[model samples]
Target: MNRSVYLASTLLICGATFAQAAPITAISELSMSHSFIINGGSEPAGIEIDTEPNSLTQSADATSQVDRPGFTPTDTSDVQVGNSFSDPPTPFEAQRTNSQTNLGNGDVATASYDVSILVENDPDIGNAEEDPIRRAVERSGIAAVSNAADPINAEAASSFTNTRDYRFTNTTDDAISFNIVGQFEAEMRAEHNGPEGFARTSGSFEMLFETGPGVDITYFPVAPYLITVDEDDPGASVAEMFFADDGAIAGVTFSGGASAIADGTQVEASLTAQTRYVFSITLEGGASMLLETAFTQVNAVQVAVPTATPVPLPASLPLLLAGLGGVAVLRRRRG
Candidate 1:
């Protein structure tokens, strides 16, 4: 059987005095993605069955390359092109995982996943000392909750990507099943009364699967909802909206503001049923919060199944049904 993939999210609410905002230098923008594929060929004429599943696997990998622009002799901020420069490249990085499984019986499945958070900060926010983006970058820990110095700047971003592939052989003597899984999640938390906390995410996935030969496969229902909120709850919150790709996939949209008296606000996002989580939690005197989390998991298997045979019904069964019908007919006639 093919397991159905789902997208969902949850919120873990915490309370604390809003803390002060941290100095942030994290990248003002980011982009990330994931993908995979599988193909199957004809089955050989053999009198044997296989029981093992082979795989092409990829796990938590954060490999990336950095490229900073080169300066010309006259283009240098200081003197000559070779002059030492004090500026760094814009912060844009990505990570991903991909995997594939092959059943000896001519069946295959492939999956891919990736997620990232990007923050754009203003150099004018207060230089490196007061700029929220730069200070956040200084820490290698959880990302800092800070926005671009202004809306005109690059808006902070969260990215997610996923792809899947599956194929099965053409042998009637074999039965196989495959399930592709993809997931992602991210969150931001702030102590109430002081500092500010924020979080947001955006992602999408594509998957494919197939059963071998004349084998049969069934897929479960897709996930139904992502975030369930009462827009009327009104405390210190924003707008929560949704978009769907028919019945196969869905997306979430959020917006809100924070203030002193209001403790905090959270945004939980779910990409798949099982989403890996990346979060940044902080406490401030005036705390405001935002969060998102998600994950996904599944397995594909190929195995022979016994066909069901019909047994002849007892001769008395038909007579018994007819007798009951006769009694009901007689009652109606009396009426």
Candidate 2:
């Protein structure tokens, strides 16, 4: 599983770093890409979902993007895709409610969501068509969103909504709490890129989350479970936590740059931009619901250092630029 591979590699790398450097105990892969069951009650009233970033903003070069998860509750015993509620369950990132669509047909059984912003003009232009995530999904014969839409106007959202069973989405900025039957272990993470380009670290560079300009990342008073720096896949099954000593999380952060080189051209030519950052989780607690502002950016791209000639940026240049500032992998696990 990619989840296990992600945690295992993080453990091996960060463990060594922390051991050698004052026992920092900080892991490089602070990103997340898994979901937990919301089985909290005989029936859950609703799940409180928030995709807003809870990390701090330390510098201008950093960026952290949030990927939303789909809500999936069975209308029947069989766990078939048709039985699930939300459209395209994996990689969900919108904020709609049961009115959109849902499962079980109960008063609040279904829900739906639509993208608010697909692309940006101020910083990254014509990014939708070049979306790496979307491209990856398309390769699997499924459809998912990158951010906004075609002819993407400055700040307009999409018009379509995903309605399905156990409704949930990759929505941002707001927590939509609809009547639900299960208690979800909802966790937020700096979403990552896969093997496609510079890797998942592109979106996670902004992982150093902060609730306020100078405030620390802490747990919400009413959180159901203790928020800690832990692994997912093998984590849920393993006895001990994957990353740290199962340290409780106060906040999340990142520190990265070209170890060999920083120039965009050099990184691509050498294929070294993939491994460019290290993520760490701060040990703090006693809070929940975090917020911050972020700019829409792409990951570090695989620049083909021109052997003899310089050329214009491709239509995919926007996506390419987005890839410029992310994870140091293999050394290579982004969120």
Candidate 3:
């Protein structure tokens, strides 16, 4: 699934002596996409379902025109969008919640904070998933025709946290082989191109899948799982985790620039007859950008596998089971 959201346009102005004609600009953007696929069974042809893809976007732009005439007027603006949905027996559930704040003062400066969270889950069984993307940017500079006398400085920070909790059960009377496969990609970039201006960006991300009882993994900054990009440095990182026995194995990678780091892995879980298993995914990341007349952003996507839980029983299942029991009793008496 592919999704993109863009928002925010504003101009900041202040009282200052027109010593030079300079147009200073500050901008920050952040977005994320996620996808999940469910398929696979022990014997019978595997079944698969696709979750409907949903997207949300928010944005703001700030510019300072101290000496240039005929420039766009300094106007403050903000935009927001959010939605959430839940339907039982539906293959998809998603929610987008966001909040933003922008500030400006006497100086030719701007600051903004944005937060957005995406969640999906199966409620009846307490299997929940939540993904949140957060970013903060602050830019300060004087409008000067020459960088020798005035300079522009801007800094942006971003973080991501995602949790996937699943409960798998074997309804059959005999043990069965259940498997899951995951495809993951994580990418990040921060760049700057201007005379006498420099740019630097860095970030760290990790993903992990664990098995146990009551394994509730909620919270940010979970142990680094995917990749970490250091300040002013650009590169990629690879990491993996495995469950014991026929359990599944998965991996994810991170890289700088627009190119995405991709990986694929499969996990086979040995589900005991008439037993339940709890598994979870804990993913986290943090990024920073510093530049002049430059931009920074991060993108992370994951294609999750299936959760093998029995389908809902039909309304007549009870009567049918009772009838079968009576027939068995009659057979025993005849024998």
Candidate 4:
């Protein structure tokens, strides 16, 4: 019999014999590593998966190229650039054990696995640090003040660029082996530069999979951008939001007046902004079978800070200011 046919027949017989079988306690661990660069920065990333309670852990470390050029190894807070710049990669590890009881069958089976993922930034590892333009750009009073108020300056901004890496592994004791894996990878670049604005760019890639030796498959989700809304206000203008997968505007819109979201608009809304909304997506036949389940909803909102007035300074503010300034200078030098 063909391998596929044989495997199918074996599974059918196993299913019948073990229809009501209970699974014995088993332990499993999973780890993954993935690496990718953003703009011009290197970052290390990884994820861990556990089976007992079924949970996943993911993390990333990133540093920008702009900050490295002037960075020194002795500078604990600074990241070095050029050939000397390197991001310390992080590893993810997980462990789990479970005992499953079959509702109707008497068959007993046990299966376990370990998976890992790692991501890293390479390619633009070393480069010179110079302003993009030969001359300094002009700034208005508002722009100057905004730049000064920025917690992360141009030098500190680069540190945000991060590289990613991922890896996964599985181990099983049962005669029948089964595993599920999926990934959605996309590279995005900011077309505009501002603290709060819309940026746009485009790229292409493919999603491939292998169930086992010789069992491989590939498919495109077509319109990759499945959902789009004001990251700040999902209820904002539907016209401002676009669903790439369908390229249909009717797929996403809100009754609110936030109709025209510019390319770089920042979304900030609270649950109290408005009632929650829901959107659903259905994939094509084959795609749907490959990726079961479709409908998902965007419900509720989270607001971190409340709107309030600034407190006024008292008459003795000058003395307090002088003392604070002295303390700040001392901390900086020591820091």
- Top-TM-score structure, candidate number: 3
What is the lDDT, from 0 to 100, of the residue 133 in candidate 4? 9
- On a 0 to 1 TM-score scale, where does candidate 1 land against the true structure? 0.25
Clashes of each: 55, 50, 8, 57
Worst 10 residues of 4 by lDDT: 136-145
Rank the candidate models, highest TM-score first.
3, 1, 2, 4
- The window of 10 residues in a row where model 3 has the poorest summed lDDT is 267-276
Pick the winner on lDDT between candidates 3 and 4: 3
User: Relative to the unseen true structure, what is the C-alpha lDDT of residue 84 in candidate 3, on a scale of 0 to 100?
Assistant: 26
CA lDDT, every model vs. true structure = 0.20, 0.20, 0.23, 0.20
* Model 3 stretches astray by more than 4 angstroms: 1-30, 40-122, 126-149, 152-154, 163-173, 177-187, 193-207, 211-249, 253-335
- lDDT for each residue of candidate 1 in 213-248, tens digit (9 for 90 to 100): 243323332444343322232122222222222222
Off by over 4 Å in 2: 1-90, 93-250, 255-289, 292-335
TM-score of each model, in listed order = 0.25, 0.21, 0.33, 0.19
Instruction: Judging by lDDT against the true structure, name the best candidate.
Output: 3
RMSD of 1: 28.5
Write candidate 2's Cα lDDT for 1-335 as tens digits.
Answer: 23323432443343333332221111111122211112221112232223333322222121121222231332211111111122332232232221111122110111111122221111121123221111111000000111111111011011121111111232333332321111111111111111121211112221223232222222222222333332232111101111211133322222221111112221111111111112221212222333221222212212121234434333233222223222211122223
Q: Model 2 scores what on Cα lDDT?
A: 0.20
